[model samples]
Target chain A: MGAVKQTLSLAVEQHARDRLARESEAQLHGMWVVIPAYNEGKMVGEVVANLVTLGLQVVVVDDGSADNTQAVAKSAGAIVLRHVTNRGQGAALQTGIDFVLGQKASVVVTFDADGQHSAEDIPALVATVRDEGADVALGSRFLGKMHGAGLGRTIFLRLSTFVSNRLSGLPLTDSHCGIRAISASALRDLRITQDGMAHASQLLYSIARHRLSWKEVPVTIRYTEYSRAKGQNVTQSLRILFDYFFHRSRGGQP
Target chain B: MIIRAVFLVLLALLTFYVFIQRRRLPFNLIVMSLIVVAAVAFILRPEMSDPIANYLGVGTGADLITYLIQVGLIFATVHYYTKFSTLQSEMTKVVRELALLQHKVERLTETEEQTGVGRDRGRAAS
Candidate 1:
């Protein structure tokens, strides 16, 4: 019994050491931050710089932005991929994911190019995938806090979440939070085909259809004026619905 | 009579062009040809559609034709929209491949330069 306790204690100490070393290990290893940007030059550089300081490789898919998004992202230490034409956020995300996966990224964390999501949440989300065995760790603002979400935005987000849950048949508190960590295995099974804002819904639906294990880690979203200017509104829900019913292929394949 | 001649001529040209593009066009050739044939039949013998129109509870052959054209237009619209969306999705894939390829080449060149410099530095140190 004493020997068993000693072995367990040593295992706990080794786990602590691993957890402490994991940041640099994950950085040198295959943990990648994929930021899909289009006309987000004003914010992407800062976002990329912050993520890079965290010691993770950042890949930014510049979706044919009219601005200097490609230059700014590259200058900020991100491997910039260029789409000669704007293919929307979904396509950009898929592009970045494919690029990073080709680089043999073991885990990919997608963050918005707009400066809304907190960089601090990445470690915990990565832990959920690395240690807790979750195929995906979705960042949920409602599970944590929304710093500047107005009543209208908040209500719309909740409604969107409800609709997404109904459509995808997943009990998620959030649908389009724009920050999630997906294991390389889970990402290999899913592909983002919806080229518009509908990709968010498509992602949730794909997750459900693929039956990947997912956990919602609490993450904060700050609704800055910039983010609000760039974000989705309630009226866009009509277009999103059309995209869901019309754009999403049968069975969520590809 | 002049308007009838103009319509017939235009219809003839349309059918000719459709056959020329039958294999290349993204629409259904058989369906379009059948519609063109039906249109020519109605244009040539207007009274023939009256009986069919009356049986379908439409007021006149002209009204029935108008409704049928609307339905056909709607169907074509739906068909084209889906095709457009598919094209866009396929284009996304092509664009993604091009982007990834560009990135790969750029990285390869960067590494080549870095390694070249590394070799020089190692020689200098030795």
Candidate 2:
């Protein structure tokens, strides 16, 4: 009986040691950067390169781009998933999230492929999610002291913020920022059904539904001429609003 | 006259069948309401029915209107069915992609586990 007890105690100690080692390994696990690219072949490679330099695993979902986005992202050491048809930004993001979650990513960061999102801001967002106990960390351009946003874009973002806050009852300062970090739990639980630009609203609704804690940190979005041209226009903004309300009226959430 | 009577009975049967089929309630309601209105009109003014039937392209007024409405409803139903099928196809594509990605992740996790086990064995041997 004494021998058996000794053996059992040793086995328990070994199990505890193994658990500690696994926890340490998890702490060192890298972040997965998911970039949804739709014909931004020019900037995708650069974005992937920057994220790679930051020691993050990158996955680029090429949403049926007519350009060489898939080739460029693959060449840049990014796991590339190509959709056969042109799905919208929301669908592309869903694919990216699925890929990143598959990669066993401890944290997932969604960065725009249009070079608007600064790679330098990625670490800050990831740190916020890790250290602040936040389920998701959003990069907000309006929260911090930032400059160089066009008047039109600022107004549009404000309108979106107002609508999202009213609908979701979440105190979010910037609801439309593309740069965000989601914990593994949040990523696994998020069910993004929006197939178009209305995904921003969907994300907010999902966060509210899941009751995930989120924070918005100050980040800079460099709006280059190319990115500005490809960005959402006034008409697109109206269409997104229309789609959101239409889906809601049809008993669809987000 | 027998042919007309048979056609009227068939129309009444179709209208009754629409109501009996629970899945198409909204459609059945619209169709049955139209049929009831037409029936009431014919019963109220039997003389006007013959003139209206002559003006229409059919042998009888009730036959022409019923045929027209049925054709229109069938076309509309076909259009909605196509839309539903398209949505189903899109949803299937999304689900298939997600499943493929999930499988890839499972394989990756297995590989990682095997590698970790191998590393542990080597350390223990040393």
Candidate 3:
């Protein structure tokens, strides 16, 4: 009876361990990280290497960068995809998403290649989709630690968030956060066509249109001098605004 | 009379060229056909434009024709602009797809060569 009791406890312990292993495996099994990069050759290698070390499959879509972004990303252990000419960030992202979806990835995460996003935040975002019932998990800088953002950028981000919130009606803390995780199911229901910075606003519009459940998680975004130099400036914001206006005027869907 | 004759000859030549290339440029043919029909109407019955112009708040028949030409020019400008934008969007899509495919092919070739080399090494070891 003593031996039998020991055996039974061992069996129970094995079952619990198996369940935990299966749960974690399921959490990461179909997760893919897509990075849309334009002229980010200088930083893409390190960015991709960082994500690869996290054990996530990474795909880098080089948006026709004149630099050696493709070679750098491939050398860093990423599946490198390229655009022949510079389609904007939105188009690059759509290409990456389409490619990953074809590979049967269940969860797709969009990470910026400017090295602004922390790879550490990815697990929680994936968990939000895998364990929780959320279809879209957006990483909000406002909710978490943010470094390197200046006063002017802060006001611009806040103003854009307010305007985008009113326009898209998502009403979250941050509207234009680049790091976002989307489920394959929600992605099927959504289509991105703006091919520009206005694509962020379009994403929120898609969320509202499809009525997909979404949640925000705190994420750290580093605004280094390199990233800031590569980032969109004031004139680009006006161009993005004009793009959204033109897109809305044309009935808004591709 | 000389101007009308020259105009009709030019219209005939345009119609012939458009019809010949109808399969490749169907939109151009349809547009040119409409313009030819309108020009023929004006040439045959110059009086018709006067009433049309008066209704459009112009004074004389020649004035009305001139106004109609301006309207046609504006319409053509808008039409071509729309066409140009659509073509530009299509071009972007094609370029993006081409880039992706080219990279994919290059990657596949490299993988094949690497595997081939590895296979040779394995045979030598055996």
DockQ of each: 0.73, 0.07, 0.40
lDDT of 3 at A144: 93
Question: What is the C-alpha lDDT profile of model 3 across B29-112, one tens digit per residue?
Answer: 677778789889988788887887878788978887787789989999978866776676687678667866876788777887
TM per prediction: 0.87, 0.68, 0.76
Kindly list the per-residue Cα lDDT of model 2 for residues B1-126, writing each as its tens digit.
565566567777876777787887687688677866676556555556777768875788667667877998999996886577459447746753964565477667778787874557657888
Q: What is the lDDT of residue A254 in candidate 2?
A: 58
- In order of lDDT, best first, we have 1, 3, 2
Screening candidate 1 with a backbone cut-off below 3 angstroms (N, C-alpha, C), the clashing residue pairs are none
lDDT string for model 1 (A1-254, tens) is 99999999999999999897885775548899999898998999999999988778999999999999999999999999999999999999999999888889989999999999999999899889988999999999989889988888889989999988999999989888999999999998778888888888888888888899999999999989999999987678788888888765543442
Candidate 1 positional error at A43, Å: 0.9
Better of 1 and 2 by lDDT: 1
State candidate 3's DockQ: 0.40
Compose the digit string of candidate 1's lDDT tens values, residues B1-126. Answer: 677678889999988887887466556777877888888888888888999999999999999999998998999999999788878888999999999889878877789797774557657888
